[model samples]
Each structure stands twice: as structure tokens, then as C-alpha cells.
Target: MSLPKPVMRGLLAKRLRFHLPIAFGLAITTALVFKYTVTEPRKKAYADFYKQYDAVKEFNAMREAGVFESVRPSGE
Candidate 1:
């Protein structure tokens, strides 16, 4: 049985008042979980990788392999 109209009941505001907090809570929880599981580990992996990374050594290796344009090939 249908009861009343919005003029009598104010159903929209009541529904939103109840559901909005729940929706916001769920969104925040999902974001936090995703950050911990995905973003945090990705940041940690990048930090660990960069911690052991050596740029000058890589450049020297590339120079030895004649990978740079400024380093001409031996056949040329």
C-alpha cells in the first residue's frame, strides 16, 4: 500500500540522510584498502628498485655498447 507524497513525508531527504553516510563510508574504506594494497606496495617497489639502481654504471655500459648517438660505431 502506497502511503504519502513528498509533501507529506519528505522521503527523499530521509533516504539520502540514511544512505549518504553509508555510501561515503564505503567509498573511503575502498580507497584506503586500495591505497594500502596497491599504491603503497607500488611505491615501496619503486623505492627499493631505485635504492639499488646505478645510473652512471648503466650509462657506462651503454657507452661501451655504442648505444649513444655521440659514440660512433667501430665499422664507421
Candidate 2:
């Protein structure tokens, strides 16, 4: 025996309302997992690179190249 039309529609609506949010939540959780897993190592590598970089050496090299004159102010 077939369900009445209104009953069928009600079942469909309830099923969609229940499952849609679950599906959406799972999709968001999965995307977050993949994003953090893929990017964490790259972020750590960048942090290490910056930690080792010598800003003073880079500044002196630029000065030697005449990119800047004396470190003293031009107003001096």
C-alpha cells in the first residue's frame, strides 16, 4: 500500500532536514582536517626559515652595494 501524498512529502522533508546539516558538517570538518594537515608543515618550515635569517647581514650587504650610504642620518 502506498503512503498518502502528504505523508510522503512530510517524510521527504524531514529526511532532508535531518541529513543535510549532517552532510554539510562532515564536509566542513573534512576540509578543515585536510587544510591544517597540509599547511602545518609548510608553516613550520617558514617559521624556521625566518628564525635563521639574519637581518643585520642583509642590511650590511645592501649598504655595501651602495643601496644606502652611511648608516648615520643624512641630517647629521
lDDT of 1 by residue, 1-76 (tens): 9976547468789889999999999999999999999999999999999999999888878877889989764566
Question: How much is the lDDT of residue 2 in candidate 2?
Answer: 95
After superposition, candidate 2 runs with Cα above 4 Å error: 1-13, 66-76
**Measured by C-alpha RMSD in angstroms, how accurate is candidate 2?**
5.3
Candidate 2 TM-score over all chains jointly = 0.49
Write one digit per residue (lDDT tens) for candidate 2, span 1-76.
9966665647878999999999999999999998799888789899999998999888877766668755743345
Q: List the residue pairs that clash in candidate 2.
A: none
Residue 18, candidate 1: alpha-carbon lDDT: 100
TM-score against native, each model: 0.73, 0.49
State the C-alpha lDDT per candidate: 0.90, 0.82
